[model samples]
Target: MPIESPSRRHVLQASLTVASSALFARAGAQGLTGPAYEVSPWPGPLTAFSLVDTSGKTWRPADFKGRAVLLNFWASWCEPCRAEMPTLQQMADLYGPEQLLVLAINFKEAPARALQFAKRTGITLPVLLDVDGQAARRWGVKVFPTTLAIDRHGQPRLRVQGEMDWTGKAAEKLIASLL
Candidate 1:
């Protein structure tokens, strides 16, 4: 059998896997297992946004008023983003939309692609489309899977800058604080 050379996609995937493993290992070693939470990063009004969900319903900050909101910025191609999605859905299910609104804002991806991922993954949370990447930029989400927790009063409270198990105790406590 001839030894086959790896394709660009395969090589990139391998590299990303290695990099992610190393990053997680280093973080674990330093006892940084959960997402990095920044309290009062905005310290003011919630960042305004008007995006449509997979169902073509427009969502705005006002739509989530009086409920704690988790605005998760993610991309279909990001491994961490994909991994954390289930936990996000779990969180959404646990709290219910009336109390905690979990919005998965697709970062710089087409609505069709985002909807496809959601359908394929059985994601019940509202997947909002940020096709132009403007929403992510406005929210200051430079990293994939970054989540911002907004208080019931529509004030941005916490900024989580990585993937996390939303069902975990640390995450539970952090989210409960918003409520």
Candidate 2:
């Protein structure tokens, strides 16, 4: 491949600086969810996240800025993930206006199954269908209920793998502060 010219490099750097400065606010992942598991400081934006929710509307990740966001990868087959749905719904109902977006990306599960699970479990959290599983690959999500907390500026603040009491008081305070 040919090398970039000086001017091109300058432009690339400038764009990176801007994306970085603004993106400093948030992210979520697949392999492991938090800063502790990030292989690099720059993980890039969580990719191509647009899915229809229960209400038959499209949703995407970028829409969650200006508030704390949670990105969670789950499957209908995962019991712990199912168990955590109500708590997540409670949080969404609680902090949604403050910009707390919870994107529960259904991994490899049929949209119908995910839809059924959400309704059966009273999971009011917005569910995104990861049909190609590319979102999971991009986020490096290896386990169920892997969660990343993205701040108001859209930076990844906390990442937790495995099940968590997502609506607990401590979690509420941390997420609220980002608003």
Candidate 3:
């Protein structure tokens, strides 16, 4: 093992700090870093739609009003979807039913399977089964773990296409902004 001298360590730390700052600054300057929502007013109340949580409680889309809601399209077949669940749980821990809503829409998965998966994995977020893929079509979801951040007015604010580091400082701040 090579030990870095005090001067070398200082230089390395300074370099790392500068690099991190530059990335953030560049992202800000580009102005295309955040998410963009293609739909507005969330279309309509999440009626005609049915979702069951681990406890068998049904959640209508309308139930998520007055708060920022996340429409997540996921499947047990997707590796990323399962891998990113912990981050989703962390977000759930941070935001309550009043501030933010995390709705996990499971695609083509049977209710029993969804419930079983949730129980085994400890995914507390309400998992709605999209048995017919109709709900996924409404959201234009082409991939697993696609997330839509909808404002209180039902307008979609951001659309993320993959697993995200939701508990990161920037993500937390962004959600806070919505709140």
Candidate 4:
């Protein structure tokens, strides 16, 4: 008998787990200490990509130059992503428009689903639709709640795996350090 290949969701989950573990290990080695969020700095410049929001607005890295960015990749079915929505909203309210830019990238989901989820959760932050998961793939996102902090220069400074308390001091400290 032949073994069946894992489903895409299963494969994604496994790869995300391994990648997250590696990110944590590297963070530990770098003497990073804080909350459960892992911080892995990008070695070089950020890759360019574009995705449209539900409003048919396209956003790219260049669009947010000179401002810090909180780039979150999520899906409507993800519990952690759902749970973190409020905190993300808080972050947006606290440091937005002029200070920080918060973008929630909906992965491999329809615009309607994402829009409904955002509406139900009252998440007013910009929700960019990654309809085909291509943008997520390019960003090396294998998990539901992967978040990256991009500095003013449009470079990724840290990648946080798993859920995070965006309204908390640790997160504030991390973002403040970038700004």
Question: Candidate 4: misplaced stretches above 4 Å?
Answer: 1-36
Q: How close is candidate 3 to the true structure, as a TM-score?
A: 0.69
Q: Count the clashes in each prediction.
A: 0, 15, 1, 0
Q: After superposing candidate 1 on the true structure, give the runs of residues whose Cα lies further than 4 Å from its correct spot.
A: 1-40
Predicted structure 4: lDDT? 0.83
Give the winner by lDDT: 1 or 3.
Answer: 1
lDDT (10s digit) by residue, model 1, range 1-179? 66656786689899999999999999888858644433346564565668999999999987987899998999989998999999999989999999999999998787889989999999989988888898887767787778888888787888887778899998899888889
TM-score of structure candidate 1: 0.78
For each candidate, what TM-score against the reference?
0.78, 0.68, 0.69, 0.78
**lDDT per residue as tens, model 4, 37-131:** 56677553577787899889989877997899888999978888888879989988988756899999998887899999989888889999888
Evaluated against the true structure, the overall lDDT of model 2 is 0.72
Off by over 4 Å in 3: 1-56
Ranking by lDDT: 1, 4, 3, 2
lDDT digits (tens) for residues 15-118 of candidate 2: 99999766654443233334322222324465566776656778776687677787778898888788777778887887664677787888887889989988
Best by lDDT: 1
User: How much does each candidate deviate from the true structure in C-alpha RMSD?
Assistant: 9.2, 16.0, 8.4, 11.6
